[model samples]
Target: SASETPGKAAVGEENIVKLQHVQDTREFFIEVLEYLPGGNLYQYLEQKEMLDEYTACRVSLRILKALDHLHARRLLHRDVRLQQFILAEPGDPESCKLADLWCLASLPRKKNFMVEEGRPCDLLTAAPEVVKQGEFSAKSDVWAAGCVIFELLHGHPPFGGTGKALVQRICCGEPEFSELGTATGGLSDNAIDLLRWMLQREPGQRPSVHECLKHAWFEGYNVEKPSKQVWQVEKLIRHVKLWGKPPHSRRNLPASNLLASKRGIVTPGFCTYMGATSVDIDFEPCQMCQGVLEVIGKSEEQQSLGSRVWYWVTKCVLSLWGREENPKQIQLKVCVKPGSPWVELGSCTLDDSTALEASIKIDKPIRYVRISLRGNLGGHFGIAVRKVAFYGYQVRQIPIALHLENLKFLRGSRLHTHAQDIHPKEVNARVHKSLQSSLRVGRRIEGTGAKYRVYEDICSGSPHITTAAETPRLKFPQGVVLIGAVLGLRYVSEVPSKESAPPRLRIQIVKEVNAGGDHERRMKKTLLFATEDLTPPSWKANEVLGNGYVDYPVMFSTGIRANGDDRLHLEILFQNFSGTAHVPADLGLSFFYVPELQSPSTSEDEGLWAGCIQSVQSATVESVSLGMRKLLSIWFPFHFPRSFPCDFLLLRFYILQPYILVSLT
Candidate 1:
């Protein structure tokens, strides 16, 4: 009755699972099947609790189709249960298919049933005959399908408990029908009647799988109701049908409640559908947009001011679409909140090649952005948008002073005087002022005691990192450059509890040019290090940079540094990147500073300095040779001379041969 493959089913039917390959390793056989992203019906039921009568009927119809596929031929899915039905699409109930065919058994040639010695299925969904005796047939699977249907309509299985008590219940007891109508939704009389016929304890008394498929419930027969209520029910079913269709074919499907984007980040602002125009919201816009909002208008009336699409996005928003014939005029508007007057963000006429890129300067907190279409030209088939995106940007500040920290230079009382000389109070105040001016706060981080919103994990009474501590300043000498830096950092915590937020260190190297004049002064920053909560080997007892110190070396080959005209500023900031709250970290310059290449007084300083010089020299040599190789490769006609070593050897012979002859004569 079915198209046969060697050891697999026809699989032409969508309800049956496709067996891709069979591998025999003598000991065991491995059947590689199709990959299904959606887990199983059991897991789906656990998530959804119970399906509504309408949704349950749809699911039961598919289960019967899968059973009929196996039953048409003499095959029986002996272990039919909720776990066997795998969904082709995740979260879609109608995408279920019969996947587990390992326990498939054939009916006896002369008889309708076969006797099995072992129990392959659980006692809960097992048929009465299968539990009492070892006999199994197509009727046993049908009985299991009935249990699944009951569980779908109700939240739990008909039979409960385990072991001997469960066996006695299934063998002799009847399932309780209380809470059937009130569990998921009001169960239709047709649904109740179908359940009663399917769960007829005796195998012969139950309807066959084909007869169950022809039931009045699946045939869309419901009891007579008021005309208005009946129309509403039909409308609801129609809406579900439209949503179930493919994306391109779906049209005018009602507005959906905003769900989290595929990235799991729910973009700010509630999305509302307005006007009579047709629009589609793409929930999974991978890299293009957080939420891809598309609006389409069929007629000129739909393009009027009354037909506007309003959406909420934060930061810099880029909205673009494929050019329709005769460019459409689009007006963009923005407001801080709903009911607030909208500020016009400029209107533009767009062509096929032009794109709309608008940067909304978030002076206050912007909550909504509205886009309205207006145009009177040829080819009025509506506008189609290909992509829309919203993102934020950060701006760093300019430093006024130059600083270089050498812990070897700052020893004992010298450290105290240097700290006092910098005016810590003024520096801290300036740092705080500059940070507040640049950093923008979101709506969530604006209210009283709202600093914790940014640092949600950090608790009250934790160490506050409100200061951006500065090191002593030193001017660069004429023609001298900054080679690199070595830092000694140690973690210091009074509270040794894991509940506290981990410390983050941000070390900024700022260079200020022409510090004498306010007009000519320009600052450049180099972020030397930004650590992400790194744990030290051991915690230190105090704020001193002595014990439990770890050394960090930062080197640059093609060095970009400050000259004599510029002053270097080293600012060490300790704060959580997720929040502005600061923790304590001891930072000190580990190695001695060498302004020029000179012999070291101690072997320890010499080894570290020598290593730095060696690295810089090696980098310079490699860069010079690489440049020469590239020049030779391009200069040669048709790239004839490929090898640089052979060319060098030839050049050496010409110069040395003439000198050797003159010496010999």
Candidate 2:
């Protein structure tokens, strides 16, 4: 430690080395303190790669003690980095000791004064508030310690960037362990939990030296005795494989981690709850891939955070879209803030017949967004934007209808109904006639759209993704289009008897006559379900009904078509009767739908406009009457004049004559 004042160099002047003429001209003093063995932990880590969490915790505890000693004496080591900690050597764990108090202060100095004094606080390990507000306290030391811990556990600092960029990132970003799981093997809940606390951006949230020692990470360690803690550190390091080990073969699976986020380059926050350790992840490639900025529609759900909203997303132009017979209805919602009750921002009909695609914009800022659409895709949700722009802190372009996994950000996809977890099993029950034939393992069947938590293949039941996701939407002349699929199935009934067979469910959507006419008949032409096989059984839900019975939730997805006429809807049906088993009890199917189908001639009205009109919203004017399978039509004449004050094209559907109803979108 050295300072302009000899006393500050070596308190009490016992080890102060007067190395120059001391006068107003200027002088330097070097402190000759006690000599101890051991280089800093930073250097040790360079050679060893990483330390076991237990050892890291012990080291952390020792460092905490050092801070406790300094803070107890009203001192603050503004810079507590790995390089500043001296190690007596790996064998002598207790030999670890703190170094460099040149920048130490009895109390926090003013921001202006600290700058003038040339404080040596390490910017990378600097407390966020210190970086943003030029402040430091006991908590600042904790933040520095957290940085050291992060390096010990992950081999690098939590944030990356150089100079000003580095400084800004540290001030705004949350610490993340991108190398969580397979790399660290798995971190101790206590270790990660404590690390999060230490790296808090708010200094007040950091724990005290006393609290650090009391952390769960030091559970089996003896903190009362310094020697005991050292012994425990070594003991824990010897056996620390914090989480379960990943099979060597499975280690090569893609790092199913986040690709980008304002939080960190890759946020591994999802690993803890997602059971992502053993699964392969293919993150959606962003504009970062094409090198062209895109307004991305992520398939993964994003956690709501206050990352400065960057775009208002005013316009979204979709192409290769679906629904050939009629215009598709699309709805978009955005969450301005986090949590419940999303706001519906836009809802419009997409029809390519008139060469006008689906595009809308809102001149406002939004935090989170979602889209629920029903259209006809040749088994895909084909959609790409010629242009997608949003205005926010800054206007930017992004992607539309993207699917991403991991704890990145939120973007919903029609392929996101989400499948419930499943495990494979063998049974001898007699399935209904629909599935009386042998079921194949590799074949796929069409059903409903669903989101999935990728893991090993169900056929092999290992830690690797077996089947690649089917292409829901490719490219279309109209706009991007994709059929939806089923995500999960929860059957609410008693398990079929051992001799009873589980019914096989094959799903598909088709055109139906008016409800009042031929209401009980099944249609033949499939619109959504276009496949023959089904999702092979993966996991079973047996926790509910005990014994030999195990229920399961099957995941599925399919194509879509507009259910134009209210009476003419789609019906989900299947055959049954293996030993006379009851139907799936309350058989219910969840599928996507688009409203109103317009013929080419009927849609032409959208293009007709009055010579001078203020605005033209979608207006449909028509009148039809139906009763007992009988249909009657009547055409109404319009008074087309400048003074015809109305926005919509009126439509009057007289179902069974007099029951009148009005509706608009």
Candidate 3:
């Protein structure tokens, strides 16, 4: 029913004829295959409204079988639209044959064809990867089949829009189902599912045409017989009815606007052609635009709902292989219109050794264009345009902690002592006075005249010394002495002996104040001491009166005495601290060993018997003023195990004043 005539003026004098390639295709069919011409299914559907299920199935099977044959022969009918099929006889539907080989491109002779990735194309009926990457195989044809099915079921394509918008929707939006549902009175789920499978994004997921024949929707379909002859005749009639009329005359229009004569302008019409030089032309303009000209490239000629168009421009260059001279430059001016923004859009200047590219966008449409070379040109360099499309933007999310400042070790001694003790006198003067006055006043008013007050106390004592008897057993009468200042006690011991014992000592602090007639009482106890030896012993205090200062010393002397001793050894160790902060107390203690008088019988000996204090120090026991409270226990060992007879061991303790304090932020 449909036939094509090229170079003949049957329709109109100015009617555009099919390109030579298309004409050759028609010749191959008519002369070689002896088949009459046929047209597209679009016209057929327009006239009949819709095809019966059996006819639809027959048509689908025929198309698929034909596609399989083409693919097997390594031939690709790139434009697989419904408009390509044609009818052979005027009224015989069974005479319908495949037509419009204009868009067909000979595939590579070898099995391998260079496939580019992420090439943009028509999106509506195109596979996802085809739109993303310009990579395709025979499976791509199956995707076209899905589109064809969609059109058959409905009146229109799945996704329909302008060039850019169509591409956008195809790449980003889902296909419309409402139209198909309405046209077919609701398609079977199996049919819908088959269509979806055929249109999957991945090419490998699409079923082959042969495989499609097995689908449930195509059940009982016949691929050999022309059972849908009436449908084919109707389709041919529709085509003749629609496009059979002569093409519209453009003679009344401006001669300059004619498509053949127009330069740098694409008319608002559809044009399909086959072969490489389908629409090639050259132009020489009097003046050139200062801006850059952008040209888009098309992978295929058929326009689908969503297809991206890419464009590029280049300059011509020439070089001699054996010559080592400088290359000449060509000056070229190009202009691009303001239109839709394009990704990977930019300008480039081509020289002998370098090429540059940039991305750009246009806001308005443009028609007339010109380009000028910057310098003398050896060859021509021009801009090329094509559609480059992509699917979607790749997106990738990445947790983040803030605020940390300082850290320090807590040791109490300025010297070797582990426990630091705070003396009653070192307490915050204000707090000390207030506490002392309160106690003094309270005690005085009560008529109980207490000389000192007990405020805060802590004990740091050794557990090794168990009994009072063992307390003085390890004491050094006239040698080095060890003291625990924080514990407010000294370990009294001498050279090991059968009767030597651990020290039995306790710490007590006294603060004297004038009572007067107010009869007030003030009490403050800063340090406390504990002894492993719990038994009570006779308390003896030795006072060293010097320069109007009274120093009281408690000595736990071992009964054993040594003679001719020249040196003394002392060792000290600290355990742990334990205490409370009600009353601020700090204890500091020192030890001294005195040598006993030499016997008159040995007076002739040159050795001297004397007591010496080699060092002094202080440590922290507790500091109530700084909110730091601790108990420190220390152990001290002294030995003067020589044969020299020693007289006495002197132990001294002092209270240090509190100084620097730290506060939290």
Best by TM-score: 1
Candidate 2: lDDT of 360?
56
For model 2, residues 220-324, the per-residue Cα lDDT tens digits are 533332221101000001111111132222122212221222211322211211221222111111111121121123111111111111222334333322234
Q: Model 2, which residues run further than 4 Å from truth?
A: 1-26, 90-94, 108-118, 181-185, 221-665
Expressed as tens digits, the lDDT of each residue in 1-665 for candidate 3 is 12233212111211111223223353454312234544447667666444544455567666777677666555555556666655554533334455544334445667523365644344556655566666566677788777877766544566666666766766776676632342223345666777778777666777887788788877643333232110100010010011112222223222122122111122332111211111211111111111111112311211110011111111111112211111222222222111111112123344443222211222111111221212211322222111111111100000000000011113232221212232334334323221232111111213434332222221222222211110111222232222212122221121123344323334332233345556774543223233443221222111100011111122222221222132222222221111110111112222212212121001011112111212212233333222212111111111111100111112222121121111110
lDDT winner between candidates 2 and 3: 2
- What is the Cα-based lDDT of residue 251 in candidate 2? 24
lDDT of each: 0.44, 0.37, 0.32
C-alpha TM-scores of all predictions: 0.34, 0.33, 0.28
In candidate 3, stretches whose alpha carbon ends up further than 4 angstroms from where it belongs are 1-38, 91-95, 105-124, 182-184, 220-665
Q: Candidate 1 has which clashing residue pairs, if any?
A: 402-568, 402-569, 403-568, 403-569, 465-582
Better of 1 and 3 by TM-score: 1
Question: Candidate 3, overall lDDT?
Answer: 0.32
**CA error at residue 188 for candidate 3, angstroms:** 2.7
TM-score of 3: 0.28
Per-prediction tally of clashes = 5, 64, 110
Better of 1 and 3 by lDDT: 1
Give the alpha carbon lDDT tens digit for every residue of 393-462 in model 1.
1100011111111211111111010011222224334322211221222233234433210100101122
In model 1, the Cα lDDT at residue 194 comes to: 84
Off by over 4 Å in 1: 1-7, 24-26, 181-185, 221-665
The deviation in Å at residue 573 for candidate 2 is 45
